[model samples]
Target: MQINQQIVLVTGGARGLGAAITTTLVHAGAKVVVNYFKSHALAEQLQQQFPDQIFIYQTDVTDKIEVEQMFNAAKQHFGQAITSIINNALVDFKFNGEDRPKLTNLQWSEIQTQLDGAVHACLNTLQAGLPDMQAQHFGRIVNIGTNLVQNPVVPYHDYTAAKAALLAFTRTTAHELGEYGITVNMLSGGLLQTTDASHATPQVVFDLIASSTPLKKVVSPAEFADTVLFFLSPWSRVVTGQNLIVDGGLVKG
Candidate 1:
């Protein structure tokens, strides 16, 4: 699981949390494929920054054809031997001035989109990447999850349910891929500061959560990126199918 000289693809990697993860992996000496749905400018900026080690692919994870094309393009650019994948793409949310979902008025189409964006994307990546990973006898798959699935303090019904399904998929994949030296795990976190996704949270809500945490602060994208790097590193080879919470002590086991 050494990241050096490895090929890793990160979905939704143009900006926000995904950007941090992509940068972290690139710094670790892994060749990175930065996937984005619409952030063309950011994707180009990242490619410019890591000219030799990074490449960009515009992909909508919810679209199976687009996802397939993305992987194909990455293989064509970096060869057909990718070693790792980080399933971190998600559809944009319309938070409606609150942290919780309006269950009674939530749109079914919106919910379906979130589920497809999260769960289906992971499934598609596995379907596309497994052949090569199994052949190479080494692979690392990390699915990003949310601490809300544990606490449900802010019931983002669609988001939490989708992530929960993703966690389940991670475990099942780990079990099936273990014999081949492929590891699959999840990293769940509470509100992460400085990400577009978290910008919707009211200042008061963030303050309250920070005060409640034993650490008294929200996690930075870099901190979360560090955990992801560890899971991708050889150190986590023995670990698989477990959801590791990184919520600054907000959700106790």
Candidate 2:
């Protein structure tokens, strides 16, 4: 299905990359359900911009019950099953490598939180949204990931480990769901130029990354979000179980 005919649920779709995805999809005429954990005001503001096209809802995607409720509400609001989902919600984390705890100091709880955000969040949404997708015989699932799995420049052990698990989940889900006309894939990116999560990163690091990239620039959230459109569009009907890195050729693999 094309974007206009799809109703998309974007977890954490109020700020940063989530906001960019919401804007991009809405502009393309997709009905969007913007899920936010705490960005009530920002979500409301985004809804105001495209009140008719966007449905702003507050829900913690990690909580199975809340996710179910959000899915039901989205279906009721749109009078149709959500045709796509962007698993973009992540637990609060900053990209300041210097401030991050050393491997010896990192706690299991830290790893658990990332797993909750990365893996568990995806699980809850898949379970809640799959029935509809099966009924319609069409669905698109795009899981947001990080290039740190391949190029762990900072070695965010907990975060990278969790994302690696998400990668596995993406492929496994694709294998299981493709028979039902659903496509599951991942879009991994490098340190975004600027986002709430990366604001703590020093400007020097950003400049260094930009200089190293073939594009000579750090990728913006909007630019990365634009690629999401292709995955959700009909052109990707046969594409699944792939991880497409969007880091401006910093890592060719």
Model 1: per-residue lDDT, tens digit, 1-253? 5798689989999888999999999889999999988899999999999999998998878777887887788888987567899999878864334645588888888778888988998988888888888898999999999988889887788888889889888899899999999999999988888688887777887788889999999889888898998888878889999999998999975
lDDT of 1: 0.86
For residues 94-196, write the lDDT of model 2, one tens digit per residue. Answer: 8999988789899999999999999999999999999999998999999999999999989899899999999999999999999999999999999997899
Tell me the deviation in Å of residue 131 in model 2: 0.4
Task: State every prediction's TM-score relative to the real structure.
Answer: 0.95, 0.99
Give per-residue lDDT, candidate 2, residue 227: 96
Steric collisions counted per model: 0, 0
Best by TM-score: 2
Candidate 1, which ten residues in sequence have the lowest lDDT sum? 92-101
Total clashes in model 1, counting residue pairs 3 or more apart in sequence or in different chains: 0
Per-residue lDDT for 28 in model 2? Answer: 94
For lDDT, the strongest prediction is: 2
Q: Compute the lDDT of residue 197 as modeled in candidate 2.
A: 95
